[model samples]
Target: MRFDTVIIGGGLAGMACGIRLAEAGQRCAIVSQGQSAIHFSSGSFDLLGRLPDGTPVTDPVAGIAALAESAPAHPYSVIGAERCARHAETAAELLRSAGIRVAGDSRRNHFRITPMGKAKRTWLTIDGYLTTDDADRLPFKTVCIVNVEGFLDFYPEFIAEEFRKRGVECRFGSFNHPDLEQIRRNPSEMRSANIARVFDRDADLEALAAELHRCSEGCDALILPALIGINRNDSLELLRARVGCPIHLLPTLPPSIPGIRAQQALQHRFRALGGEYFLGDSVLSAETRGSRVERIYTANHGNIPFEAAHFVLATGSFFSKGLLATPDRIVEPVFGADTEFVPSRSEWYTLRFFDRQAYQAFGVKTDPALRVIKEGKALDNLYCAGAGLAGFHPVQEECGAGVSLLSALHVAETILKIEN
Candidate 1:
């Protein structure tokens, strides 16, 4: 099959790009091999939370400007602060249009409390996770953290203790799901996802809400693990309607329901805009002529070949298998794009676990236009975005979603400009 654009990787970057291109009336296809790294996302979009020197960033717009002046090779630097700001606005517009309402803005960031009781500064967060005021205000009195009986990841007591350390009047509460008896029979199946699956039913949710309504009375606000529902907005609305109070969600480890919902919303909008999506398939290889990619071959039922006028490489970094680390070298798997890495593997890591690791900064090297470069030459029709792009440690810098979102829109905008 042929399309105007073929995006590899069905993560946030690819989905964002596909949505924008499809909205612009381009034929687009997104190839995916099951779940994306988004399932592990905190459901918050972080721009630049810290400087390379480990300084916390309060104003992301100002941080980007400073970063552009200092680190010219950083992805945001190459993309430019002006374009990055514009792309952020465009990204917010597209996400809202796609039914994912986000809270926060581009100018300042909010230090959102994590399930681990630590705070992460982020640019935009999904609306359901924030307080009703939409400000970075914490519930001062009668704050309750709800823990599911069998959920291993979220510890309400630990979270409450942490909050107490910060002088917040926090309390912990636990509720045993009626369906817990069924899952307790199989210890292995008692995961957050399985529990969420059980909660997907309105009847199950209503029961839980009744329990919460009793437990949550006189509480100023209820902080729960993000397991309210997998459909996020719908589940949040349902829970709000039934429970009736201010609700804040804390991100738990892995299989993130909020992230899943965001991806689903983007995918839904992409398809609604006439884009094709091939899940449980991966781009195995590609055909390239000179600097232009001709087509890509996926590991479909018949080794399907997909041709596109433009190809986007959002396959992500080592975590997503976009880049492979070997005993000898770090290599880009599919397109063999040049990777920005230290030559010696010995320099890849530091002695202390708390210290920053060099390997985390390893990824693809992209030109200013966000095009993939191989052996010092930019590919004509190939673009790169997301974790695959080198120059920033996503965890340390807190710019994963920011880079993905902005770069995706930037790539789409670049393609549209060239076409125009």
Candidate 2:
């Protein structure tokens, strides 16, 4: 198998890079191992939500500029704020092109209502999800949080409690149809995805609309757990139209329907542009010729090698096994790429659970051009992006999505420039 580029992970970063390259008439292939961290998304993308000093960011463009100065070794710093801003715009347009309708802007950060009802700063939110320009003020004065009867994942009462604290009139309600009764019987199986499957039917959706109307009386808007649209936004749009009042979705627990839908949509767009997607496949080893990668062998296609001019490592952090930690050191398994980590393992994590941990910042070392370094030499054709690159704490700084997206675009732009 041969392609112009081969991406080793099919998460947001890999998909973004693949889509960008494919759109430019490059043959791209993405090898994915099951699901990515997108399954745990909150239906929002973050672009420098907080500075390294833990200051909440209001404007992301300014935030990037500050981030570049404070965290000089960070990926955004390496790309520079000017290019990061450009990539941010391109990333938004790319999502729209892939059928993912998002609200908010890279220039400013909006407060997205989390599942716990707390406001978290983010860059781009899915269109149906609730977001506010001001964290202290909500758009609707009165709201009713509705959840499925037996779904334990969504806590309508908790959300209502939080809303009430904000001086808003809040109510909690639940409605279940006969179609969902069977799935509701099994406590474990009644997840957002399964409920969404039942809601996919027109009749079920109509019933839900009627139920929401009943529960939403005297309320300015209705807030429902995101369980209606698994594949597309049409179901949520139809429900909102049928309900006759403003309806907003709150992302449920992990395996988020909106995130999965976005992933599927992006993959579909890549395939439409003549890109190949290999899901449930793992890259086992690579064949390197000095500083350039020649081919990579996968677990499924044992002996068959995927040959490409450029290779990307977006396999993610320790969560996805992109960077592994042994007793003595951190290692990038596939290509034996050099990693950035403290020599002492004792400094990996702090004693406080909520405190920033050092291990989160540990990842593969890369050059200013985003090329991976192996044994003190940068690989000519191997680039690293997303959570795999070193130099910043994602959770603490709140820039995971930004790094994933902008770094992918930066690497893609570099590859395109080299191609030209």
Candidate 3:
């Protein structure tokens, strides 16, 4: 198959890039082996939550400017502050068009409640996650944390305890669902994904909504876990019909239902925009003509050749296996691109486990145009985005989705310009 662009990895970056191209009448394909990091995301897209000095960021736009000055090699810096802000707006608009409601933009951050009842500052969060306007403290009079009975991943009591310690009016409550009883009996069915499947049914959602309606009384807002529905918008609509108050969801454990919904929404949008998505398939090898990669071979479809005018690599960090870490060094696996990292492995980690680690910032070396560079030579037609591009520490700066979305959008525009 031949296309305008072929993106490797079906993560946020890849999907965003493909969708942008597909929307612009360019044929695009995303080859994905399995689930992306979106499955484990908090469903909140953060943009510079904290500074390099561990100081919490108040104004994210200002923070970006400061970041550009401090970390010029960072993806945000390479993308430019004004362009990063523009891409941020573009990402929010793109997700909104995909039926997801993002609450913030590049100007500032939103504070959402975590599973542990801690406040998290994020740039753009899926609607119904943040119950309060205050990022530092809970702004509600009475908060009710609802837990599904036998849901092991969520801890309502723990959240309640934290809220109480902070002198906030909060209560912990649990509701029993008929569907959960059977799932709880089986060990394998105890996962968030399994429970989310059960909730996907309209009857099951209505039943849970009914129970929540009865349990939550005189509470300012209902703080539920992120497992409200698998279909996201549909599930949220089903519950909203029965429930009376505003509801917010705390980020759940792995196989995050909201995350899955977000990922699916982007992929579905990409397909709807005339983009092809090959799931359960990975790029095996690329045959480059001089500095350009003309065709790529896939693991599942080895014999069939996939060709594109431009290529984007959004395979992600070590967690996504985009960049492999060895005892001595870290390497970009796909193109053997020169990676940004410390010379010695001993400098990869720091004494403070929670602090920014050098390894987190390790990824492929790229030019201002995001083209992969090895030995100071640029891979002309190939571009890299998301966690695969080196420089900024995602966890420390809380710019995971920011980098992914912004970089993808910027790269897509760059490709368009190059086409022109």
Candidate 4:
């Protein structure tokens, strides 16, 4: 197959780049191994939640500017704060255009309630999920934390305890329906995704609405786990119409329904714009001519190769197999791209688990243009984005989605400019 651009990973970065390129009349294709890190997301995108020194960031634009100066080799610094700010606006509009309604902006950060009920700073949060502009204050005084009867992922009592600490009159409630009993029979299968499948039907939603209406009689709002709207974005709206009080959702543990929905929605948007999507396929090797990557061979297509004028490596960090950690060194597996890591394996991590580890900052080495470097030479047609790129720790800095998104946009814009 031939395309204008062939992205190696189908995560947030690859999808965003493909969508941008396809929208501009460039033929784009993406090869995905399986699920990406978005599946474990909290349904929130972070820009620069905290500085390198652990100081919280209230203004993301300012934070990016500070990051550019503090961390010169970081992706945000490479893209520059001016372009990062512009790309931030573009990303929000792109998500909305793809039918993913989100709240918050690039100018400032908002607080999203974590599964443990802690307020974490983030850039964009999917709508219908709880977000407060101020961490010290909540919009509602009285609220009810409701959970499915047998769902073990969400603990309403823990959430209620946190709310009470904030001086909110919070209470806990449980709802059960015949439709959920089948899934509840197996503890392992009673997850957010499965519960969302049951709630997709109108009959099941109506039953849930009736139960919520009874539980939320005098409460200011109803807080539930993010278990609806997996297949349909309007599931929450439909349930809200049938209930009395307002409804807000809190993210659950892994197999996140909101994350899955966002992934599905973005892929749908990319395909709708004439982008080719090759899911469940792995890139086995790449064919390079001089400094340019001519084509890539995948596991599914044994002999045939995907040819493109430009390529993007968004395969993600070690967790996604974008980069491999061996006994002596870390490596970018697919194309043997240059990576930045500690020379000694003993210095890779610290004894404290919560402490910032050196390995989190290790990834492919890219130039100012975000092109991947191999043996001291930059690949003309190859670029790197997302967690695969070196510098900036996502977990420590809380800028994973921000770097994934903004860097993808930067690479896409660079390709478009080169084509023009």
Q: Cα RMSDs of all predictions?
A: 2.0, 0.9, 1.5, 0.8
Backbone clashes for every candidate come to 0, 0, 0, 0
What is the number of residue pairs that collide in model 3?
0
Give candidate 1's TM-score.
0.95
Candidate 3 stretches greater than 4 Å from native: none
Candidate 1 regions off by >4 Å? Answer: 130-137, 301-304
Better candidate number, 1 or 3, judged by lDDT: 3
Mark the 10 consecutive residues where model 2 has the least summed lDDT: 228-237
lDDT for model 4, please.
0.92
Tens digits of per-residue lDDT, candidate 4, 1-420, equal: 999999999999999999999999999999999899999989899999999999999999999999867899889999999999999999998888888888897988999999888789999999988999888777799998999988999988888888888889988888888988899888999999999999999888888899888888888899999999888768888878888689999999989998898899999999999999999999999999999999999999989999999999999999899999999999899999989998999999999999999999999999999999999999999999898999988998999999999999999999999999
Work out the TM-score per prediction.
0.95, 0.99, 0.96, 0.99
C-alpha lDDT of all candidate models, in order: 0.84, 0.92, 0.85, 0.92
Expressed as tens digits, the lDDT of each residue in 301-370 for candidate 2 is: 9999999999999999998999999988999999999999999999999899889999999999999999
- For residue 366, what is the lDDT in candidate 4? 92
